[model samples]
Target: MQPGIHPAYRPVVFRDKVGGLAFLTRSTATSDRTVEWEDGNTYPVIDVEISSASHPFYTGQSRVLDTAGRVEQFRRRYGDRH
Candidate 1:
């Protein structure tokens, strides 16, 4: 509750680059860029590379790791006893 010691927390817009999704949330983060929100006022625009909209796990686009190939490669390279 100390004045001037805390950063200002207000509504900010986070834009996901890949999915082109945006959402408003309260944050202390600030930016020089501004955009007119749906509520009709300018707010700081924060650009993010990944969000739930575009994330592999959330979007069900998750990739399977090539564990078998990696294990074979590791055995060929270092698992052999000299």
Candidate 2:
């Protein structure tokens, strides 16, 4: 490892607003915003649009695509070759 070349790694907070979830972890990412954590310490907060808490795949809320409908639509648009 080189000195004075690597970004500082420190504890930071990742917030998922949609899921109302926040977690503290080490990261090189920085932010001007800050928040008080459960441990009574302040850390930089990063707002994220999606995380495992709210993600469809992780939450098992994924939407099932209507393949049959799509196939029928395609056939209607262009007569079936068969």
Cα deviation of 69, candidate 1, in Å: 5.3
TM-score, cand. 1 vs. native: 0.78
lDDT of 1 by residue, 1-82 (tens): 9899999999999999899999999999999999899999999999999999999999999999999999999998899776
Tens-digit lDDT track for model 2 on 8-45? 99999999989999999999999999999999999999
Candidate 2 local distance difference test against the native = 0.97
- How does residue 44 of candidate 1 score in lDDT? 98
After superposition, the stretches of candidate 1 with alpha carbons farther than 4 Å from their true spots are 68-82
The lDDT values for all models are 0.96, 0.97
Top candidate on lDDT is: 2
